[model samples]
Target: MALLEVKNLGISFGGLRAVNNFNIQIQEGELYGLIGPNGAGKTTLFNLLTGVYKPGEGSIFLDGKNITSYKTIDVNKAGIARTFQNIRLFKQLSVLDNVKVGLHNQYHYSTLEGIFRLPRYFQIEKQMNEKAMELLKVFNLDGYSHYKASNLPYGQQRKLEIARALATNPKLLLLDEPAAGMNPNETAELMETIQFVQKEFHMTILLIEHDMKLVAGICEKLTVLNFGEVLISGKTSDVLNDPKVITAYLGE
Candidate 1:
């Protein structure tokens, strides 16, 4: 079965059908791309998938179990995590603390145990910190672990956000424009990091990227959206070369 399947997905706001009749199926460990011109509802689709916004119609299944109406936190616990187009790190917190926030849900200690600073709390906190540090190392941010998140360079800030999301231990990762504001060097490093994540974590990834170079470099397959509807989906080479996709981006 597909790792993620969405059928007849749709949503709207006040008579504007922002997204309609969307459908896709992603296999486990697939690196899939969601691409379209601005305002194509790519982020809206991510929100629906992550439960930031519930779909008005259609069903979402992860590993063959329905998760259509699960709330955001529940969705994360159910194994979906995402990074935003805008960096969403806790700016004032230490980089390590930012990652630890994602690990909070995994703490099994009772509320009283946490409040009283019991042994379980200390044990779990230590484990979480070690795990968070490992994730920072993967993104090459270990050296900045003690710095405030806002103190990192813009590119490092982006990596920290992804590290925080990974700390949730998700099976499916949705990245929204992860390369939005990077220089060429930073973008290159991001491609390598993404490759490392796919190989090391063995996770399914759905990426929304406007940078064709990044998408072309990594995505095995792609789906194109136009006016909130699917224009086409196929192998990366075929989808990018489609005349409809070209026209959608460059105008007829």
Candidate 2:
């Protein structure tokens, strides 16, 4: 069975359809790309998959279980985690603390244990700290573990956001324009980091990005959306060279 599947997925805003008749099936450990011009409903699809927005029609399944009606937190708990187009980090929190926040859901201790500083609380907190540091190391942000998330440079902040999402231990990871606002060097490093994460974690990833170079470098399969509908879905190179996709998106 596919790790993530969406069939006939759609959503509307008032009188306008934002996403229409979308369908995809992602297999285990595959890297997929969803690309299009502005207003192509890319981010809307991410929102629907992550439970930020419920679909008006169609079903979403992860690991063969229906998650169409699941809440946001429940969706995360169901093994899907995502990073946003705009970096969202706790500005005032230390980098380590930010990752630990994602690890919070994994804590087995009760609220009472946490309130009383019981042994279970301390035990779980220590383990989470160790794991969070390990994740930071993967992004080369371990040195900044004690630094405030807001104090890091823009590129590092983006890495921190992805680290936090990884702490959730998701089977499926969705990234929305993860390389946005990055320079060439940073975007290059991010591509390597994403490749490492997928290999190390054995996770399925679907990304919505505008950088054709990055998408071509890493994505095994591609899907193009135009005006809220799919323009094409196939191998990355074929999708990139398709005249229809070029006319509608690449504009050449």
What's the number of clashes in each of the models? Answer: 0, 0
Clashing pairs in 2: none
Which digits, one per residue and each the tens of the lDDT, describe model 2 over residues 1-252?
Answer: 999999999999999899999999999999999999999999999999989999999999999999999999999999999999988999999999999998988867888999999998899999988999899999999999999999999999988988899999899999999999999999999999999999999978999999989999999999999999999999999989999998996466
Cα displacement (Å) at residue 23, model 2: 0.4
Question: lDDT by residue for model 1 over 111-188, one digit each (tens)?
Answer: 899999999989998998898999999999999999999999999999998898898999999999999999989999
**TM-score for each predicted model, relative to the true structure:** 0.97, 0.97
How many clashing residue pairs are found in candidate 1? Answer: 0
Query: Pairing residues by index, what is the TM-score of model 1?
Result: 0.97
Q: Give the runs in model 2 whose Cα sits over 4 Å from its true position.
A: 250-252
Q: Which candidate's lDDT is highest?
A: 1
Q: Which ten residues in a row are the worst by lDDT in model 2?
A: 243-252
lDDT of 2 at 35: 97
